[model samples]
Target: MCEEATRRQVGICLLCGLPGAGKSTLGRSFSATILRQRFAVITYDKIITAEAFHLALQDELDQSREIPPSSALLKTQETSQWKQHRQYLLEYLEHLIVALLNSSELRPPEGKCDGTWYRFVDCLEEQGLISSAGSSTEKGTHSVIIPENDEVCLVLDDNFYYQSMRYEVYQLARKYSLGFCQIYLHCPVESCVLRNKGRPVSIAEDTIRLMDKKIQKPNPEKNSWEQNSLVLDSSQLIKADDHRIVKLVNQAMANPLRPLQENLEIKEKDRAITAASILHQADQSIRRCISETMRRVKGTASAHEMKVAAQELQSAKSQFLEDLRERLCEKGIQPMTACNATTIVSLFKEQTDHIVQPFLATEQSCCLEPNLDCNDRASGIS
Candidate 1:
């Protein structure tokens, strides 16, 4: 293992926009002109090669025994395969970042990493970030080193049409306590389609139009996590000399995000309190219904008969509470507001009536029987 590398302030900058919105062009221009530090534009399109996507699609097809012969279904599968490639690219970037942070040799990813991983490593090597230096001491692995004192900002160039896609990058930044920022290239759908047409390998115009509808432009006011973001109109020429871009990068690097900390003790305590409140509500409702039933039958029945009925109701209440507790534990107790009193009272009344019905029937039978002694009837003898 290498000694700890210089703890420089590393940051991740995301270039997001629809295809042919000039994200890659802007990244190139920025990397060439940005001063005092190295910038590596990790383009997703290059990493997720055509061959890799074909294999992914093949795997998806192989997993399904029968795929319906529908263009829409095939398109959905293609999108899913593309997303898998995107995820793998993110993992590759994360692995690189981990190696840099730990000052360790760049080990190949374990378990099911395909050719794309090697291509990604080769891309970094080409940029002079990592190099081949395997020794006899280390067998069957690549030994690479990050250059000293190079505060590299990894500029991720991708068509992040969904906010969720960008959030995944932000989460990675937070996990490693790295500075993060987003740059969104805003271009009209028509202009993007026109620009895409000029390229040798063009994306479908319909796909770009679909992405335009789905794309979520970063709004700092709406999302606190996206405060370190900038939107540039790609219709106009964008240059690295732009002061706003410079300021945004500098500000993000200055302030790295802290990971969120969860307090399990507090959460458990809250759940316990909620469960207790629900149980208490249920108990009170059952007791109130039992008392009402006893009061309604008080004029016709003896004190001893009322005591018998009360015992039966109490037993049913205990069983109901036990079942309620078990339910809460299984499903997680809901909030206090969700525990409606009227609903609880109605349920308790229904169950309580069922429990007390037999006692009422016995009393009625005793009264209707001729030859039954008055003292025996008062005693509630059946």
Candidate 2:
């Protein structure tokens, strides 16, 4: 069908990485390169920024009523409002993308205008974000129309890892029969932290630390999606004179379907690994907690407390065994002998030292700092 063929011609490329990982920069460069060959590019960041700007303006308008009239207050209010307005604009752009994905009939609003692009500016002006429709329409009138016969290459330079958005992107690509490729810009945590320090927009250190912790832990559910990924070490590129990012981009563009298929497989594996790791980690934590309780209860421990601790430990042991069995089954590892709870617990215990060592070290580190702080702070307070 003509409709199916049109959908097949649409291509989407996703650039994903931590903030300041060069996702936007690489996306822009790739867009420019592709544009030279006469391809259309649509960036998620540009759309989101426009929405953020509009939301900022609305926020300002809401605050203006509460503040007494003063030059400083007025200026501050105006700035806040402008920021809100920018957010709204970005949101509108997001909505536009969603609309386009949902219906083949949609086109960029600015592209639809037949008169001078100034007509598009007038439309935005009617929304009241801009003071006057500037005569020089060169700045704000850039728009692209999806042609009936032309192939479109869409470059998304935004955080596509968010569950809802990622799913939307995936579904859109499939629905449109678009070839999709995701380029993951992998950066070292230390390097990312250093880069964030110099940037105006930065994720907080604590947030980054939490992200690091999450990254280090494996989740079985995530294995299903990890198969479809290509990782590029941005940290290595940061030191190079001329990074071969373009080469990678070209390779991705050349074989989009292969990478997408591979990504799907990788995702499955990642999910299985992650699920196994979670079960293991949770069991270790539970055991450690029970051990500590046992120590505290040494001589005068209540019967109820001892019973609860034992129950907790038993629950963790049971769950860990269950998870391990599930993983073995998933991997097609048939048990020659039946795996009972006792056998499973004994098997896990044999591997406990290796699994629990890192956790023990982490626990020690956590306790060391807390003890030090308590002693010093308590002394000072007294």
Candidate 3:
């Protein structure tokens, strides 16, 4: 589905580079270089504060952990929360984009909308997105004013060092139905580390080295966003008028990208994921049972009474073991091997096996509760 837009110039510019690679500089200067592009800049550095980010991540994790058992439960929980978070963030970004598009049609009071353009910048500023440096004058007053252009753009600045980072921006654009492209600023690691040193709050040399290792250069062959992307050699000066950049910008203006989301497709995927999770949890549960049995066996310390009781408990659960295999096969899961299933079933029965041991030779009944106080009989304390 294509996002509805009234202006031709509306799109997203994602500026990605290492620390000290001039991302901020490019973001600040992007609009001025284009003749008719009205633009705003959103620096990721400001939007994601360390404390806020950590707290947010913790909340996502906590919420995810509440999900019921399934395959890769922890991993699935994390993935679900992240997708939800991205969708929410996309909604938030759409509000700003809508406000800007509305502002483009601004006129005098008689023809005016409910509020003025100030509300637009004010709302964004509160969200930690500042207007581009040159866009403002007289102490941040005129930052939101545009040059009466037919279209406007928003530029995102960040150390988009990973392909996943860029992918998020691409997904956002698709969701909003906007034209989107990335400008990959490539610089030598040595140059970036040296550049980082001059910053007010410098990054450690080691951190820069590690970040360099993690950086993923775009490949149009593997990523659709890269097809329209530009690679700027930030190791040297690149002009806005550079042929490659101009071509990309003009192409976007002429034909902005549309979104691709198939709800039906996703619904089917979710079902499969749910099934996998259920099966995975069931499998893990079996292993846990085996481990618990092993613990019980070791805890016995070779007590003769406990061993006899354990054997009795193991015998009592024979029917339960038979049913477990049938249940797993119904769900298309691999039926447990005879040896493996027996090993797992042995654990739960081990504690029960000793119920008769304490009574033996003392006229105690063999029929005792499976969950009776094991400590009174065979936890092997004696």
Candidate 4:
């Protein structure tokens, strides 16, 4: 999968952290202030914008600008488009990694030689976003501060919230025989929200809380990327050319990263089975909650009782997600993607009408048959 290379020091350096946790700030400072411009940055926002253009084109094919309903056809098409887009980005990033190592091979994935990928590559060349192609040892800009070599640090600036996303980048590093390191900026949810508020385009506070709940911390026991990572407290103001920032630059440059070894790899089918089993267990829990709520409320239940029962159902669903992640670890599988997890949760919700219809009917019965025995009512509801 990789050619022989003289350089393992020049490769992907992922800047991972929560939103407003100072990753973008650190990336800029490390490249411009610490290392003095011997690096190329590829931001995730531009990658998303590049792919969004193609999605915008899809509506034109139908000759209507109106947004479609959440139909199965639309979901399938969107999934396909994203899968292709991910592949294109991987190929593009891989090319940059190769160019950094001073390797001679430069071939884009077939069909991407002309489309969005081509234009993006040209833009990189024109703006010096990526290193000059083939001439790997050449100086990109007049930098008297940095060393002269084929090594140009590549900064992957993004909100890599999931371990799966980080793992994907780590796999790319291994695939091309290049050194890899991660800078995980750790800031509390409260701190990040406060900082985010100061931004011109602030994200919703609820969205930040939800991410705080879902974001997986780096675990060195499992992932190789975690071993060579830096967990920085980004809650404070970091000056330009701060010692912490300078130390990271020196680590990536002088100290060649040790080979990051993977202890396990997960397959797709097993992950699917894990997902299904999780939802099934969650369904059983919801049914139990409904049954228990009926027994407790007896023949005096109200909307409040129903609401309490619904809240129990939600708790079960959250636990099911946590349980599924642990199961993935035991079974050597990647944790479920956010899209797939949301789809499963939505499917369970679609069944909510059926699930709650019985509960509501029981509530109606409580009012209709006040004289009825509690045990008899519970049995009837069940």
Candidate 5:
């Protein structure tokens, strides 16, 4: 499949972090740089935002105007929104690319997307035919139909504070079998709050405080989505050497994919060994119990006594040994082995105590029931 001529190689880069973490800036720069090298670029947030804007306008018009909005009107509005959104997204993306190119982010300089292609997309967006500077698609969707052989790189920039959204993204990526890397920008809480101070739509300080108290402060461990992330400190970016950020990005991109293979193999081996050990132990315990019971029956003096002794022994085994076995299985150990090792050992210990002190007083005084004394023969004896 990788070698198929018709298959286009697509790369997705996810820029995730707290608000004002430079995700938008960095993503724009990266996309622009890649486009300049003669490659197709897509920005998910920009496209979605355009679609949202279009829908907002459509809804507004639908409410105010008496004429029912045509499918074409709706389509045009969506197209217009996406087109504008993509244009802005691409412009910002170019800014990011320029930064990366000037800095040391990409080493040995990979292939570049020529200016001709980007200029063409710009022209299409300007003409309103494409409705999106990035890619053109049918109404109600972000995907743009392209030639089968087009090589495309997509940059996804969005707020990912919610665990559910992150998981949804993960599932989407897996379903499509997309190759992508996660880039997370870290910023101080104060910095994040300060960056949003003068924005048209600003998050409240109290809300930020609540987020810190309820969301960020509680989890010390990174979630499943953050496991494969490339974390960079945005605070240090301005003061640190330019080469540091470049090196960090390069290192993340260069990480080997072989680790996943090794991890799977190790897990499989561990499971097999655990299963075998538990099964073996259970078998041994069962055999030992049978042998001991047979020996006891042979030494019993009368048929009636033998029957009672057998019943008591069976009851004890069932109560303690069987229960222990069940517990071991529940704990993920082999049921038989766990029961035999633990229950058999305990039972053996109890039996040995009885044998070692056969002459000791077998009865003791009871406190609960006046009619049921421990010395009563009806209470049963060893």
Candidate 6:
């Protein structure tokens, strides 16, 4: 009848902010306070450093390799390579999740991973989340142990400055129907720079400042998927027993993300409704313009003249409506309200004047010369 006995709960917790924003500090607090669950904190900096070192060593061993001409160009290339390594880290985490879910051996897919994959595996082994499946003699045989208590949390500690980087993890959670949440460690740029100076492995102050400007903190109002997120000011010391942090994690684990599905039927139905609404509004606006135009010219023309002008205007309206509908719904050339009321009325009046101008002119000619027949004048022209 307990929570764990029912089903194992697994989730991803992202700790993201600027360097020295105390994300690692908060993650440790979370793991210590959150009871009756298995927790593993994956520190991205350590793995990234290992990968960078490997690349550096490779460059050193291969001295014949060509180097960039300028230091600026070299720095840019290094930044690009680091981005690739981050991508590989995400892929490695994805593979680990799959192995845990399937209760299978943790082996890299053929040609899908690089040196970063082994470092990731080593991190997991260090945390006791995975163990060697074969004897100690085997180098790469490993398997994930499904937690007995049915609750597991993987806290990813990194300076995920871009929304897209966090989105990748969200997608992974949705793919596996796992709970997902984020924690943003908010601190002044000055405070972060000061804190970075105190760490044994201090990052460059300029790099920390640059990341502070680039960091995109979680916004639930803007992004519905990031609803279960917590923001704590890392300038102040965070306690292990923070209520807000605890509540955020509990809510995420309670409601896991649903797997993605393409609902083509719903999408088609929505398109149909939108098309109908657009046409209906256009038809109503065009009809109102026609009625207003007729009212203005009512007393000026004879009844017969009015009747003839009305017929011509109705024909023009039909042609305009057909064109409008085709442009809006069929070809998707314009938005529903792209042509405002004033613009529509002005365009319709132009067509209306063209259609009814002859009638008004003919009527005026008949008034000036009573002896001449209006019918003869009209018939003789066409």
lDDT for 270 in candidate 4 is 61
TM-scores vs. true structure, each candidate:
0.64, 0.39, 0.49, 0.51, 0.38, 0.61
Off by over 4 Å in 2: 1-3, 6-8, 34-143, 146-150, 161-164, 215-228, 238-382
Model 3 residue runs over 4 Å out of place are 1-8, 50-91, 101-149, 261-382
Which residues of candidate 6, in runs, are more than 4 Å off? Answer: 1-7, 50-69, 133-139, 146-149, 267-382
Give the winner by TM-score. Answer: 1
TM-score-better candidate, 3 vs 6: 6
> What C-alpha lDDT values do all the predictions have?
0.72, 0.46, 0.56, 0.58, 0.45, 0.70
What is residue 125's positional error in candidate 6, in angstroms?
Answer: 1.7
Q: Residue by residue across 175-230, what tens digits does model 5's lDDT show?
A: 33444456667778788788768655565564554444333311216554345555
314, model 4: CA deviation in Å? 70
| Model 2 lDDT on a 0 to 1 scale | 0.46
* Model 6 lDDT per residue over 1-382, tens place: 9632454567998998887788888777755684555777888877887445334323332333456556445555555677777888887777777666555566665665466777777888887788875534144557677564457878999877778889999999999888899988898999988988998877667556656655678999999898888888879888546878777778888888998887989977787777677667656766766676666668778898888888887888888767665655545433344334335444555656676565442432111111322333212111
Candidate closer to the true structure by TM-score (higher is better), 1 or 6: 1
In model 5, which range of ten residues has the least summed lDDT?
A: 103-112
Task: At residue 347, give the lDDT of candidate 4.
Answer: 37
lDDT of 3 by residue, 1-382 (tens): 4434443457887788777787877766665585465566766544444333333333333443454555346445555544444444444456566545555322212222222234444545554434545643333332335443456667777776668867877776676567787788998989988888887756667656766766787889987677888888898766555677667766765667677756988866775665455445435544455345434445444577556655654554554444444454354443333333334433434544455434434432222122333323311111
Error of 3 at 152 (Å): 1.2
Off by over 4 Å in 5: 1-6, 34-151, 214-227, 236-382
Which one is best on lDDT?
Answer: 1
Task: List the pairs of residues colliding in candidate 4.
Answer: none
Clashing residue pairs found in predicted model 3? 70-277, 71-277, 293-347, 309-353, 309-354, 310-353
